[model samples]
Target: MNIVGQLAPLAFGLAVIGSGIGVGIIVGKTIESVARQPELQGRLSSLMFLGIALTEALCFIAIAVAFIPFPKP
Candidate 1:
């Protein structure tokens, strides 16, 4: 098997895992901030959603890459 064929799944998995971790951290911090300042919940929530969208985009990109054909050696 080609090297890229072997590694693509690993790369895709890592990308998704990393994205999940990033989103988790963002949500955890946003929740903590909201608890500390209820009045800022709206702003915090907006920021959190933006963060989640951006983080998830990485996983999508990784999936796209996984489907692409690897160059011939």
Candidate 2:
């Protein structure tokens, strides 16, 4: 039971890992782009935030799954 409990969250963690990596990359690139083109910060920031929201939704789904009960044999 302990092993199963541990493994359950691992699955959710794995799901969030991809979204985390992608959000990190997206945020980094957005920062770089804004740095290079400061004049476009207003436009770029909005789109960047929108993308971040979508990416974070994946992690939120994983978090939801983490607390949900799974059927056992």
- For each candidate in turn, give its C-alpha RMSD to the true structure in angstroms: 1.3, 2.6
Candidate 1 lDDT over residue span 1-73, tens digit each = 6877788889888998999899999999999999999999999999999999999998899888887886786
Clashing pairs in 2: none
Decoy 1 TM-score against native: 0.87
Q: What is model 1's C-alpha RMSD?
A: 1.3
| Clash pairs (backbone) in predicted model 1 | none
Backbone-clash count (model 2): 0
Per-residue lDDT, model 2, residue 25, is 93
Q: Least lDDT summed over 10 consecutive residues: which range in candidate 2?
A: 1-10
Give per-model TM-scores: 0.87, 0.68
Model 1: how far residue 5 lies from native, Å: 1.2
Q: Please, what are the lDDT tens digits per residue for candidate 2 over residues 1-73?
A: 5565787778787878888898899999999999999999999999999999998898888777777776776
